[model samples]
Target: MTHPLVKRYNLAPHPEGGFYRQVFRSENETSSYIHGETRPALTHIYFLLLKGKVSRFHRVLHDEVWNHYEGAPLQLFQLHQQQLWERRIGGQGNEYAEVVNAGNYQAAQSMGEYSLVGCTVAPGFDFADFSFIEEPAMKQWLDIAHPDLAKFI
Candidate 1:
């Protein structure tokens, strides 16, 4: 069955997996203090994950803040600075909002039936600044940094 969020937002298939719709993109532009890439000041989007679907490991040049809206919780995994970390978002034990820093490889999956969440990116989100990590690379990194999370990737 189609998730309500997908219908409500008219979400489309995301390359990483799941579904998403770009909801807001600021017209303001600025050079990234970290990456030095020029982009919008802020960008917002609705992201939805259904059971059995995952947002594959990927990285964005800007910091992203995720806000929980409704439905199931999500587990967000990040690989950064040679370390692996996982954070829960939108569940009883999780924070309603969480941040994934710039340059960190991040991914997420629903913990139950479905999850509807929003993501805001500082310095905006651009396809040129997005990158998906290859499976072998992710496996090797996970094996060393977070062996327990290897199965998810």
Candidate 2:
């Protein structure tokens, strides 16, 4: 299947598996069919793919700027370091995504892994875009949300 957006911002692995290996990654850990490199122009960049319903409790470590490149709509959530104002991000399609307020939104697209293009005001990125919820709930959600995909991650 050919996607126009893919052609629009064409990027490939510098050396197949280079980035993954550098981070000691695995197809199991992150359901990444392919991982995009760190953008030079951007201070921090992480392009990842999740197989199914993903509910994370983490928020942007810093003020984040994001755009979805492919896949389905990604839900982004955040609670500022010292504020209670919550934010949510969701829209249809992957053609363009730039949410002004970052908060507690579900990156729940239909199916298939979605591409998330984002950079934080701080380099505290990488896996820094994380939120850890308690067990049982997290685990149970994984089982029901992403039956097949959950076992691997």
Candidate 3:
């Protein structure tokens, strides 16, 4: 059976993983400092990750802030400067919100049955600015440098 929250939010399978529904997109556009291109000022979406599913490592040209809403805590993993780190969102003693800076690779999964989070992107979100870590060399590097986190890829 489909998850109740997935049905309630009318989410669709995301290319990266899990399910999501875009809830807001700014009507205004501006030149993005990070991308040096004109884009929507902001965009928001509801992202849900099921226990067994994963949000594959990917990078975007804009900063994304994730806000926890319900269900289990989300284990957000980020790769920056060849370092892998994790942040838990929506659990006791964990942050309610966390940010993934532009150009940083990130992935996530639910710590329990499910995790629902609200993601807000500055300079907006466009598939054109998104990229998955599909390079064989990069995967090999991750395996060597952070074997534990390679599973996320």
The candidate maximizing TM-score is: 3
Q: Give me the runs in candidate 2 sitting further than 4 Å from their true place.
A: 1-42, 53-55, 77-95, 99-113, 126-131, 134-153
lDDT of 1: 0.86
Compared with the true structure, all predictions reach lDDT values of: 0.86, 0.37, 0.92
Q: Taking the tens digit of each residue's C-alpha lDDT, what string does model 3 give over 48-126?
A: 9999899999998889999999999999999876788899999899989999999899999999999999999999999
Clashes per model (N, Cα, C within 3 A) = 0, 10, 0
Residue-level lDDT tens digits of model 2 in 1-153: 423333444533321110111222222222211233232121344334344434333443334465554455554433233232323333453335443343332232224544444433232234534444335655565567556434222
Q: Candidate 3 has which clashing residue pairs, if any?
A: none
Clashing residue pairs in candidate 1, if any? none
Measured on C-alpha atoms, candidate 3 has an lDDT of 0.92
- Local accuracy of candidate 1 as per-residue lDDT tens digits, 1-153: 787778879999988888999999999999988778788999999999899888888899889999999989988988876677788888787799989989899988889998899999999999988987766765787778677655556
Candidates ranked by TM-score:
3, 1, 2
N/CA/C clash count, model 3: 0
Selected candidate, larger lDDT, 1 vs 3: 3
Better of 1 and 2 by TM-score: 1
